[model samples]
Target chain A: MVRVALYTLLGVMSVVMVAPLVYMVSLSLQTEAETLSAQAVLWPENPQWGNYAELFVKAPFGDFIVNSFVVAGGITLAHLLFDPLVGYVFAKFRFPLRNTLFVALLATLMVPFFVRMIPLYVLMAQLGWLNTFQGLITPFLMDAFGIFLMRQFIQPIPDDLISAARVDGASEFTIYRKIILPQTKPALAVLGLFTFVFQWNEFLWPLVATTTPEMRTIPVGLTLFNQEYFTLWHLTAAGSVILFVPTAILFLVSQRYFVRGITLTGLR
Target chain B: MSLSARYARTAYLFLLPALVFFTAFFYVPIANVIATSLHTGPQADVFAGLSNYADALADPSVRHSFLVTLGFSGGVVAGSLVFGLLLALVLDQPLKGRVTFRAMLLVPYLTSVAIVGLLWRNILDPQLGILNRLGLDQQWLNEHPLATIVGVTLWQTVGYTMVLFLAGLQGIPETYQEAARIDGASAWQRFWRITLPLLAPTTLFVSVMAVISGLQAFGQAYIITNGGPGDATDLSVFHIYATAFKTRDFGYSSAQSVLLLVVIVLFTLMQLRAGKRGEVTY
Candidate 1:
């Protein structure tokens, strides 16, 4: 009886967790009249396909999607290259100030990104990078979290492999490239997913930094769409569904990495 | 290669980019903000002692914003953790066909916070929402908007917290539970004295992550409420954005940011202390 009750509870809670998503998908496909009907439709009677088309026609969502991809992709690539190299050095090499630098990086993690907003914005404005992809991606491309993630993963790799590569007259860069980088696919997949999802959903910096519609990411763009078409819930839902697709696909493909990343990060 | 020279060169090579980027992008900008906050007038050269801090302290909006921000964050942390742990415990049960359920629960964590905010705003829409259609006619936005926003945040993050908890639960040794059962402990007692205590480290880690993430919250409020219905959800970060860009009071905004950072640091310190206390428990 207790076992049966436990299953029932989990079954119910899981439904509650997923109901909003299901409802959003359902509402996106429902006609305005049907959506606003006195009785809610759990499943749409007639799924409207035009709402998805109207997302692009009615709003600047296509540009938003492109902007999201570019910013997220740029940040992920930068982190992958920069963090791993730094992490590899931190893990393998023991030098003066090594401990200091590592501590400084970890300390940097504690300082809230909120603290630097005003100064960063002013700096961006001064550099004429505001409302540009460079401004959106540059500051965020290399982060403490990525470095920390890379450091945690790289610390586990054996030293003898790098030593063997070094004995073969390989330069430090070559050792990092050939020896360390290849072994980091799993970590990279995890970090890449995180960075991509984070940047794709990033709203504040994009909203403040980008004045032009062309540079707006999907989240900020979706907000503008919400404000512009407050009356059109169907269209808004459709646009949200569109924004969700890439992230959902990425998560599905990288589920194991996501699971491992979350677990290891928590373990620390 | 000698140890000293090879170490020096390799260290410099490894640290170059991260140090440059970190200093320029993060530390220097923060330092500039502090300097800017102290400066006065258009030239921003003359130091005005403690004036910006005084002004920020006196501002009712900042104070109110701090209170509201605390309330919202506290609600999210509590809600997410409780719901998440509950779901985690359920999912951790030895049951048939649990894998599919686990995947379904994780979908929300995978969804973008932006989409989650937008989805919930409409999900709780006053007139035409499915919630209203189901005869729950309380005005989620106007009447109890704060709770509504908190509910949305909890829904979105519960999955994430649950996954962490699930991992933590799995890490608990089976022998401990067996020993407890052999000693005549009931299941609930075993969970309370054994499982919960063993899970302290995970709980501490999750709590710290939750608190820090909660303190820096931006996307959800910006998307859902836009700190709306007359500034009910005017969180500190949102206020900082408004002050810097909308009002163009960069100096004042910097002060606000400092104050916000101090609050987060204090919270982090408290969590670290609590985590230490838990370490003693084991």
Candidate 2:
């Protein structure tokens, strides 16, 4: 009886959580009429695969998807390129103000984006980066959390590997390239995956950074689609499905890392 | 140079690029925001000290938005947390399909906030929502704007807090609970006497995160109601966004930004304080 009650509770919570997603997909595939009618249309009578294609014709949704990928992918790749390099230094190197610098990074990590968004916007405007991909991507390219994550992963690397390489006259840069880079690939991947998903779901910065329709990422772009075509629930759901797909797939594949990502960084 | 000095040199060399980005992206802009808050004008060229903050504090909409935000955050933090702890406790019990259930629960959180907001907007629409046709009818978003968004956010975020709590629950050794069970303690007693005390650190961490994120919530307020039917759901960030973008009042917005920053930073300090206290004796 106790076990039954527990499963029932889990069942209800899971269904509650999963139901909206199911409804979203189902709603996406319905005809506009089905969505509009007073009666509920839980499933499309015939899945309107055309709504997906319709989004592109109605707007530059193809551009929105590409922009989402490019910005998210750009930020992820940038983190991959830079985070480990900085993380490696902080993890292994003994430098002046190193602890202070890392602590400062952590402090900045705690500073929510909402706090700096206005000044950052003003700064972006000053630089004429508004409505540009760089404007959307640059500020996020290297965050303190990425560096911190990489540092935690890199800290465990045995010092002997670097020492051994140095004994053979490997330059410090060479040691980083030869020894540390390969060793930190998993950390790099985790950071990359987390950054990509996090950035992809990102609404506020992209919403602030990109004013033009073409520059908007999926989330921002979809909001406009949602507002403009609020009557056509099917099309709205279609736009939503586009925004939701990549993230759902990524989260399932790397569920563990995503958990660790949040638990460690307290970021989504 | 000494070897240690040389190592430091190389470390700084490697660190140079990041420090530049940090300064350019993180520190400089942050410092500039605080600096921006201190000034005023169309050009933001005037050195008007504290007046913008005074204006921001006195403005009724600003006051309303802040209170709404506090209420929203309080609801989300408290509700999601209690539900999260309960769910985590349930999942902690030995059960079948627990792993699958855990992963399935995170779907809402895994999806983007904008999309989640839109999804529920359709489902909870007053005119023709599915729930209405299904006989569970209410003007959810219209009448209870704050509660509706809070409910949506709780639905989305409870999974995240659950995972944190689950990790905390697992960290606890089986011996203590087992001992409590043998001493004729009910499950409730074991939970109160043993589980709750051991889970303090996780509770602190989760509460701080919930509070910080709660205070910073924007996408829902932005996407769901556009800060709502009246100024009902105008979250602080949305209000800040409006002050900066809509009204072109950077000075006022930046002042509010600093104030919000103070709240986030205080909660962060609290988190940081308890961060070192995670070690618990059996």
TM-scores of chain B, in order? 0.93, 0.95
Instruction: Report how far off residue B88 is in candidate 1 (Å).
Output: 1.6
- Per-candidate TM equals 0.95, 0.96
True contacts kept of each: 0.76, 0.82
Accuracy of chain B in candidate 1 (TM-score): 0.93
Off by over 4 Å in 1: B1-3, B40-46, B280-282
Residue A116 of candidate 2: its Cα lDDT? 70
Poorest 10 consecutive residues by lDDT, candidate 1 chain B: B39-48
Model 2 alpha-carbon miss at residue B240, Å: 0.5
Pairs in clash, predicted candidate 2: none
The DockQ for candidate 1, computed on C-alphas, is 0.72
Backbone clashes counted, model 1: 0
Per-chain TM-score of chain A in candidate 1 equals: 0.95
Give the lDDT of residue A168 in candidate 2: 99
Best by TM-score: 2
